[model samples]
Target: MFDSLAEKLQATLSDVRSRGTLTEDDVNAAMREIRLALLEADVNFKVVKRFTNAVKERALGSDVIGQLNPGQQVVKIVNDELAELMGGESAELRFSSSPPTVILMAGLQGSGKTTATAKLARLLREQNRSSVAVAACDVYRPAAVEQLITVGARAGADVYERGTDADPVEIAKWARERAEREGKDVLIVDTAGRLHVDENLMKELAEIKRVTNPTNVLLVVDAMTGQDAVNVAEQFAEVVQFDGVVMSKLDGDARGGAALSVKSVTGKPILFASTGEKLDQFERFHPDRMAQRILGMGDVMTLIEKAESQFDETQAKELERKIRKSEFGLDDFLDQLRQVRRLGPLQSLLGMMPGLGGHQLRNLRVDEREFDRIQAIILSMTAEERRNPDIIKGSRRIRIARGSGTNVQAVKALIRQFGQMQRLMKSMQSGKMPDIGALMRQAR
Candidate 1:
């Protein structure tokens, strides 16, 4: 997630912000450090040069030098230039006028093309489209068709696959026809990938394109490849003439050069970013939010949007009422946990909040085993016990703990923590809570 680059940039900005007034030399020194950081992050040389120049010009402009908070002004300039370095705005998927908008997925081997196909289908499903089908045209790899079928099934989409003997182009044509007959609104063609850019791959993809008449040709680039990703995108664009780019593996230790330089280098906007292996790990690329992330400022708007998308309003309101009344029981806590899980991993969601990035939540690993333990404990509770915890005497607590495969003390500690959290929420709602800083200290 560009952790190294983010650290470097945050340190550089902190130094600049510490200075009450910034002279030309101070700005130059800061820009020099930023240039080094970008280069160390493996950014393209041309992009680095252009970015440094734009940032320097903006920092030295009268608007910044004359501002009351020159440090904030300089950070603002860098953020703006960073956003511009990526696409200035998030790009939309281009749909054709006809039914079955064909989308061709292209990438090198191991770029997660097959998985990205299902992620895209899930994304389209969220848009209220029906009957999204994926066509597996990768006949070279023996298990490629089955792999896509498994992913498509996980995404709740139909998958069309032909055996290795079938020509990929023919499979694509047939898949599209089947989608149309089945009344599918979109058909994604997962084409073959090469170990390296080759003429054979390009020729096959071109034939598939000709047969399917794809509305959008998306090039999936691995963000971990850094500047090499830019070169790959350029080569694919030349051959496939793709409409947009999909940057995958962004949740890994990607230096982020690909995301910043791909669109600028290839003249194609980034349509989506694949953050993880999960089917719901895809997000539309947002230039502004990405700018905030690069600058160590979290993406609050994107975080809120994700919450809104996954949260059931009625359940949320009910929980809110319980919290206000100090009646937040284990059932409500479990419900809240499920809602948060839908928004993605706990650490990732927390990292999107302001001042909560960096190593703030590093020690709190949200592993599946921990979630299972919590669920087991909750399930061990009787219906009456969950509704009214005060009725659970020591014997009942021990019994529940034994049922959940946990010790008695662990069960007692969870009950205490839940009670504290409920009381804290009630106090906050009533405007009687202490400052968050003090509460955090007490929690620690």
Candidate 2:
């Protein structure tokens, strides 16, 4: 979503970093470029101005102007200011000392409030090891209760609903009581939302808050709405209190203005981001890491965290042993591939690698179906053929290709690539660096 903005900012920073010296004009030029980039990204005008001023002030300060590497200092200043503008650090969800921490979810009707509720419930259950229950207090929209019932179950959280017949406030109150009785670790109240921020919406939300006395009130904002999302958050801040923000639809084609400007406009930190449609794609937002990504510096920590979540330590050790023994068969390869795919889309994962952010990432197109095709080819192979690829003669290869819905050439290419990979692994196991250029030539 930040692709356009990221490209412009990264280009500006690249120019700044190429210089050996610095001038006030240079800093001003960079700030102007940044201001334009943010404006083009639909950022709040006031936020853009404030952010640029901060970056410019620091870039012109004595700490940077006469520094040994002034340009690098300026880049650092921009990165720091950007992080500060979003939120200096990641915000943690406040849990009650008592059982059943209540989290009140508020947002506009189309802001993905109900979906965010389920996603947040799943996140808390996994990360906090909490037994979560979600209250279906959104009785206004058609099928709201049923929607919660379906998604809430998928999230592995108990759904508390009195159906659309019950008052939202009463449902919230009862949910709190039930969660307490059941000794649940958390209870997320999914409240009703309006097409816009209106009096009825605020009043109902206030009533729900009054009844539930939630530990944390989270306002869900659609990142796709850009500046309008920031405006809605500001309006909510004036009438009702919310602890933090959840920026949803973060993977959309929106300019990312909402996620960048909400904290600055409303003084509420973004606690979570819904990056994809899947419930598991939701994650805690880290401002510093986001800032680095925007600046074309890869987020290695987030990459590692995602990898650690998907890869099993014991399985990793076994896989290593298999590679060392030249026993890494196609079955093992398929297992490893499945695990990597579980870490999210291959393109997004590559974007987290060092030196592949910004323009480089924009140009890369990862065909996910290639994974499916590879899996199909591997699955078509018999157990003996998978274990011993040398026995896959011309006729065998033809049969496998036919079974896998591919041509014979595709099958042969895959086998050749696997052979090259095995040779590379053998070299690594023997305490020698593989000849990558030679291996690539062999695969071709």
Q: lDDT of all the models against the reference?
A: 0.78, 0.82
Evaluate residue 252 in candidate 2 and report its C-alpha lDDT on the 0 to 100 scale.
Answer: 96
Tens-digit lDDT track for model 2 on 155-258? 99999999888888899999999999999999999988888899998999999999999999999999988888999999999999999999999999457799
Number of colliding residue pairs in each model: 0, 0
TM-scores, all models, native as reference: 0.67, 0.68
Measured with C-alpha atoms, the lDDT of residue 140 in candidate 1 is 90
- Compare the candidates by lDDT and give the number of the best one: 2
- Candidate 1 residue lDDT tens string, 189-272: 998889999999988988899999999999999998888888999988878789999999999845888888887899998889
Candidate 2 similarity to native, TM-score: 0.68
Candidate 2: residue pairs that collide: none
